[model samples]
Target: MNVVPDPITTQEQASKERENLLDFFARGLICTTARAVGADHGEPSEEALTKARAVADDYLAAYEEWLVKLTADNAAPGPQ
Candidate 1:
């Protein structure tokens, strides 16, 4: 008979994977925030429209950075 892994082991593995994925997103946000605002980040000083503009203005640069990170992650050997 083919053996199966324990459910607890599966769950722990899933949880760790989720944590690693979240960390990747958190890193993106950190990099984006650092670029959009000063290092000591706070609430956006501008209104929604302006904040929207802020992001729009640098959309390509941010997109490139995010894409590079995502591609690197995708090519990673296995789950972190």
Candidate 2:
């Protein structure tokens, strides 16, 4: 039996995936920065975490913008 996925469910999955990516990126940045600064003892400092989140937000925004442009270009009609 073939089952078609609901559009809403697919959208939700994409949203969740983005959220997960943001988290992963932020965490990685935090760890990398901490190690570079020789502060990788335990948990990252509040300041480092904040900076990492900011960087992650900017990265995600740029990525989303590029994706939108790519999608729009692909959707445009070609020569008739």
Root-mean-square deviation (CA) per prediction: 12.4, 5.4
Give the per-residue lDDT of model 1 (tens digit) for 9-67. 57789677545544455555555777787676555443533544444536645776998
Scored by Cα lDDT, where does model 1 land? 0.61
Whole-model lDDT values for every prediction = 0.61, 0.81
Q: Cα deviation of 26 in candidate 1 (Å)?
A: 0.9
In angstroms, give how far residue 47 of model 2 lies from its true place: 3.3
Please give, for residues 1-80, the per-residue lDDT of candidate 2 as tens digits. 99975554577798887777777888898778778999746776777677787899899999999999989988899943
- Number of colliding residue pairs in each model: 0, 0
TM-score of 1: 0.34
lDDT of 2 at 77: 100
